[model samples]
Target: MPITTEKEQLVAELSDKLTRTKGAVLTTYSGLSVAQDTKLRRKLREAEVEYRVVKNTLTRIAAAKANITGLDKHLEGTTAIAISYTDPVAPAKVLSEFVKELKGKNLEIKAGIVEGKVIDANGVKSLASLPSREVLLAQLLAGMQSPIVGLVNVLHGTTRNLVCALEAIRKQKESA
Candidate 1:
């Protein structure tokens, strides 16, 4: 069966969005008030996340077109999407925080995609809990440098001990 013209257009647009999006978080927003939705949108905007309320059918079509499988089960009940084209974790983190703030209201994380992998709700939460990009990069650098630093310190201490031992021997000989 052919979809209506408007529905087809919506599906096409959503497919485009999914295709171009670097990362995407699918959520359910059922019981949010207008004010709360506005607040959530603002927060997402601040984080450079693109927020969209999508129809489930259209979303499913888009997901299929994008070759993202097993997401149809998650496309139920007032589906919304937060897409992050630049920062993979931005939408996940912001949406997770917003849901937490609402005390787990009608907003529920369904699933997400990162680097072409389908992640479930728990996976999305874990991604949200991860440190920011800069923090992660810093930690990685520190971890990479620790062993080198330890090796350098060990070499220095050994060299210093050898020098001290030679000096002590020289002093004893001189005294003798």
Candidate 2:
């Protein structure tokens, strides 16, 4: 059936948002009950991600205009999109965890877009496996500081040893 005027407007708005998003994940959701669907939507909302089941044709048009090509191929089956505007990895992590919990839900990640680049299924999985922004920043800080800390400790040890040797020599000289 042709989409209604309101639906067209809604799709247009969603497409605009998708165009401006930093990352988006496309997934094929089959064998999910209505209750499961509601749960998924709730989780997505909690993560501040937008999830929608758009018509494949409209999706293709929006994707092409936004320079996201090759997404049409994965548009087959019962497709839904999760768009993330602020945090690129949020949608991926959420969807990956949801799929894991569902187990036999038959939810397959099709593809994704990150920083205007199209990525396949494996790419999405890898993206999902990435740590959050705060965690990554903390790890980076630790990595950057470790060498400096080691250098400081080494310098302190050398200085302490030299001081101890000087003290011993002074004591021996005084005794002699």
Candidate 3:
């Protein structure tokens, strides 16, 4: 039998989200209480992440359609996926922080797909260890600006030297 229209629609929506996502972290929310869940959702939302509890079967189909492989193994159990469309590291950071706050409760990161690469839980944590996207971009811009600043200073030094030489020559001529 074919899948129902609603199911197909859900899969399509998930697949589209997966396609547009910069990164996604899949975790099992087994023992989470309502309050903790709400707090976690709020944190993720503040970071602009989309968190969804997905049916593993439909999610598996959607992941494959989105060209994300190696996730099927991690799709088992009570799976929730956190998708970050803008900053690739936001979901990982938020999820890791929540896990730490919970003292490593039933919230377990199974796997992640970042920039089209599937990684394990350790990899996800490592990603979280990185600075935020804005910080990284600022660092890059500063690094790139350094050379330009150095060149401008070098040009100014040459002009300064020429002006000093001219001034010295004028002083000598006036004395004569």
Candidate 4:
């Protein structure tokens, strides 16, 4: 079948997004109310993530063009994608939280991609469980600094001990 111009445009656009996005989560948004969808979109927007309902056929073609594999099976059934260009964890984090809030009223996670690697739903959950990039960086910095801090304290203690010993000797000499 010949592809229509509009579909070609959609494929091009989705292809671009898939290639450029740092991370993306595929979800099943069936049974979601308008209000709930709006709330989810707001939260995603605040996190700087883009959420859109996608045509599975167009997305499959786009994903192929983007060199992304292992996404075909998960594209079925009321698909929407949450894409993040900056923070890899933002989409998963927001969607997971939103799902929790809904109490399983159909906003189910399907799969996700992070840094070009495709991951399953469980993997998405684990990704969501991770701290934000900033927090992880802070933790790493603290880990890197702890040894230096400990070494400094040890050096200071050694100098203080030497000074105390010297003072003790001086006091003994004065008394003698």
Query: TM per model?
Result: 0.87, 0.84, 0.93, 0.93
Weakest lDDT window of 10 consecutive positions for candidate 1? 14-23
44: Cα error in model 2, Å: 1.5
Candidate 2: where are CA atoms >4 Å away?
A: 1-12
Residue 50, model 2: Cα distance from true site in angstroms: 1.5
User: Cα miss at 13, model 4 (Å)?
Assistant: 1.6
When 1 and 4 are scored with lDDT, the better candidate is: 4
Question: Residue 2 in candidate 2 has what lDDT?
Answer: 82
Tens-place lDDT per residue, model 4, 65-142, is: 999999998988899999999988999999999999998678999999998878999999999999989999999999
* TM-score computed on alpha carbons, candidate 1: 0.87
Top candidate (lDDT) = 4
Compose the digit string of candidate 3's lDDT tens values, residues 1-176.
47799999999999999999899999999999999999999999999999989999999899899998898999899999999988889999999999999999979999988987899999999999998778899999999999999999999999999999999999999999
Please list the residue runs of candidate 4 whose C-alpha ends up more than 4 Å from where it truly belongs after superposition: none
lDDT of each: 0.89, 0.86, 0.94, 0.94
The sequence of per-residue lDDT tens digits that candidate 1 reaches over residues 84-173 is 888889988999999899889878999998866789999999999999999999999999999999999999999999999999999999
| The best candidate in terms of TM-score | 4
By summed lDDT, the worst window of 10 consecutive residues in model 2 runs over 6-15
Worst 10 residues of 3 by lDDT: 1-10
